[model samples]
Target chain A: MQAKKLKYKEYLEKYKNCPTSDFIEVERDAFRWTGTDVSLEDFIPVNIKRKPPARILDDSDKMCMAYGLSMFDTLNNALKKYFKLYKKQRIHQQEHFKQDKGTKIAMINLTKNDGIADLPNKNNFGHFTFHEYKETNLVGKISDLYSVFKSNGDFNI
Target chain B: METLIFNSERKLKTENFARIGDLSYFEGPLLSLFEDLTNGNFYFFDWVDRDQDYNRWIIYRVLPKHLLNFLNRKISHLDLFRQRPEKSVYFTDIDFENKGYFYYSAYEIESFPKNYFPNEDSYFDPEDCNSIDRIKSIIFNSFARQKSENEYSKVYHIHNLKTKTNYCNQPIGRRSKRTTSVNKLFKAIKFEDLKNSPSFDYYSKEIKLYPDLRNPVQANIKEDENKYS
Candidate 1:
């Protein structure tokens, strides 16, 4: 029994580096959603593995940490840029402090279903496809978008 | 809120107060067969394709901190509630036939030698079976009253340490006709929500029942002996 389980454990390692390729293909008039037909392609398999929550931190906690780290980096870079632009400004001045801290904004996703991919489907024509339909509300706050660099502006559609 | 897997028909056993159910999930036949082949590592539950003598609904019970870490470790995906388990329980239509014995693993396997699924049964100890009377007390807070068909018993929640905040009402995964964004399965419910929801109450302990649930025909003898019996 031990030997067999060991074999399975070895086998599972193959799935560890599961491929994360972009959609496989998009076919013309192959996928249907809400009365619209579209072609779709490329389906990346998300190999979900079970892990105890007590042993690992939750996703939300990790997301919050990422947000905080990015914000810190952003503040650091903004201060560096301000110092470079105004080299003659004294370190103690109120204007320098104001310049170091730039105005920033943040947007929170009110919809809880975040990071979902299009549904995978098989067409009658023997082709694989992915389908997507989205509706969400984004609530914005006059806070920070934490980053040491400029905002990417790569907004999710 | 935490996620739970239960046989819906088991919930109806409130009348008998004899046996409780084991936690079960569907797996591929090969994997299931492998587990069964192991030294009684897993107790066999019903095959998903059982005949529909009765509908054995495999419903997800979303509660805060009710599930064990061992069971939680088996949940590989967040979208489990959206997918139907393979081989749903089918029942025979005849009313008088005896079905079979229920068996399941009550213990969780934490660390194991590599190369196999990370689980071990608490053994085939029938004595470890749960008591319906205790479950009824936990659910309805009453000892012996039978639960009416439509009268939903107060669902019970265990305090899962993983969920400090409940998001059970929030939309999870995708939306469907029978499921609303707010009412979707796997959604977390806040502690306040768990406290306030009309459907559930909290329980603090576990109870065990001996022997297995089987037929013991006791006639009501209300009308006739030979005719009714």
Candidate 2:
């Protein structure tokens, strides 16, 4: 019923510092005010070689590393993929939202196709979703997003 | 366990990930990364057969505490840690940047793209492999091969937030959007601090930090399961 306490002196000398230690760390990718926060390793811990899971705080609830979305390249890559498929489709994106339960779910205008296919607004026009992440069943996907505006109340869009 | 001595004598900690923990609880309250009692992996799932009692979730094993604090300092004042392989890792006394700016979603001091570190390829084609199984295998292998070292860690991208879309090869900040992307944010962090600081504030991590991995239920390990098994 009791776990073992970690002895610090054991691996202190082996800490890969410099470039290795200098690498930025943070919460998982899925953590969100609107959605879930994902870890470097999906779940199989042994798979986190170079990623080395982020550090936990004193309380263990707070994230040590930081989070930033790679929008430019992401959008660029998405557009490139869309173009490679359609060849001549104009692309566009508009963010929309609604309050449900308590979180905000921003719905992107997917005017043409799922963007995975191709058409107008096809550059990187895939749908955007927000949701919470699960830990046991290996379930991760779109759900909802958080909004500055109150949910189920006065909204601008 | 002379793990360090053994590693120096002969490296055993392969780049593959190690098991941090498991998921037996799921009642639902959006768990924060460092919360005392939250799920390890932060994703959502539903049973193909709802009545079949099958649900899949993710679990994250929290790494050493000092690692987390170090990462926080790096990202919060990202400009400081924005060095290539040529720089040294040390804390500085330079005033940290705290300009309040919300780029992509959260409020970040600086936006990305200004300091984007381009990888060989930004997007990964699932079709690169002959079949879906091959793609999954590629993902599994890479995940297994990745190093826990911080340097290589930069190229890897995984999220705990709500966005389910797979980022693939695209590093953060490849876009010119507000900032918040990975590449740009890390690029913008104030590396100058480490280069020029009077007080070694960030350097003394071990002395100043309380290495507690029991972070309630929040987020974020290295490898070494095979040999032990």
Candidate achieving the largest TM-score:
1
The alpha-carbon deviation from the true structure for residue A149 of candidate 2, after best TM-score superposition, in angstroms, is 39
lDDT of 1 at A59: 21
CAPRI classification of candidate 2: incorrect
lDDT by residue (tens digit), candidate 2, B80-179: 1232221211110101121111111111112222222212122222222123343233223333323333222222222211122333233433333323
Candidate 1, superposed: residue stretches over 4 Å from native: A1-157, B1-100, B103-171, B174-189, B196-229
Candidate with the greatest DockQ versus the true structure: 2
The DockQ value obtained for model 2 is 0.02
Task: Name the lDDT of candidate 2.
Answer: 0.22
| 10 residues in a row with least lDDT, candidate 1 chain B | B26-35
Each prediction's TM-score against the native? 0.16, 0.15
